[model samples]
Target: MLRLVLAVLFSGALSLPASADVSIKRLFGKEQRALNAIPQTHLVSLLERSKAAKVSSGGITYSRDWLAGQPKQSGGREWRCLAEALYFEARGESVKGQFAVAEVILNRVSSASYPDTICGVVHQGTGRKYACQFTYTCDGHAEVIAEPRAFERVGKIAKLTMKSAKRPLTKGATHYHTKAVSPYWADKFPRTATIGFHHFYKQPSRLSRN
Candidate 1:
């Protein structure tokens, strides 16, 4: 089942149509609208980076060494937003934790309750005081990526996570907070996974009984 799913996604990723302008916008825009209009060049850049990491039969090994070996990665606006979020929020976390945080952002993109794009989800409530999805966005401090190596590590993770098939690492979690403090919403959302220093949660379903 997993291989079949991976095959389908891989096929889709490689199925660029013959055209003068081959681009992710042409290939996946209809399906992955949450990515918004990713520039053609950014998609090509990601594909180039993917070539450096040969697929292993044993599957992904989450470690700094593994991430370091992957080619340095960058992408358009959406990818930058996700990469920055991981750098700020989960740089200190284990590889799995970093992926888990990325999962939350992606989950929010999938959910109707939040914005449809990665940048939109990451900066959902910016501008007003105390109204942002990610603290780094609204925390008043500049989003300075001072640590180039850490940024590169998270950038690679962001690249892979964006391409990864929807996995159960966070079990569909859309929210999370470090274990140090409990937010008011923590008690309300169902806790899904506890990984590293974060506790992940899935927002309650909003189905209405008529």
Candidate 2:
């Protein structure tokens, strides 16, 4: 009698719907293919939206879209100083690279070893050959902004960094030099980050401050 009951239950189970046998992977495969069929521009727009929603330090998030939408107006003296420094030093760099350079400048302003103001720190060694903190300041060439678009981009970056963004992208580095040349001081400090064409470092004693 027990054998008869077991055989009857097994036959009834086999008669259930074939859909019940479908695996999870098979069920989701159709959905995944549909997502893959989306247009590239639409996918990119979705990604940009997600990035814009992400918050960095101090509740600031920067993206190309955000920067492009900013007003094209001049800022105060400090803003001009930072914007000019970025334009001359890293205009050709990637957007993130430009921001990294700005971080170094702001880091110096907050450090004990450097000047407290952006202009002071940027022009620290100007007028002396090979002594300027930034080469453009003492390169003996007029500081003319020939590229309006580039200046505008850096200006937005400067404003964003000065106001709401204070995250240390360069690992608390206060100094950086291009990859084409190795400066004597680079060896004296610990290397922190290498962004785009520049190598960043922080003085060993200043690590605590960073």
Relative to the true structure, how large is the alpha-carbon lDDT of every model? Answer: 0.79, 0.79
lDDT of model 2 at residue 31? 53
Q: Which ten residues in a row are the worst by lDDT in model 2?
A: 1-10
lDDT for model 2: 0.79
Which sections of candidate 2 miss by over 4 Å? Answer: 1-55, 58-63, 206-210
Off by over 4 Å in 1: 1-58, 207-210
Candidate 1 per-residue lDDT over residues 1-210, each given as its tens digit: 223444586577665555623464454445465344667656544443443333343255566556777889989999999999999999988777898899999998888888899999988888878788788988889989899988989999898888877655889999899999999888888899998899999998873110
Candidate 2 lDDT by residue in tens digits, 60-134: 444566667777757899999999999999998766678889999998998888899999989998987767889
Candidate 2 displacement at residue 100 in angstroms: 0.6
Query: What's the TM-score of every candidate structure?
Result: 0.70, 0.69
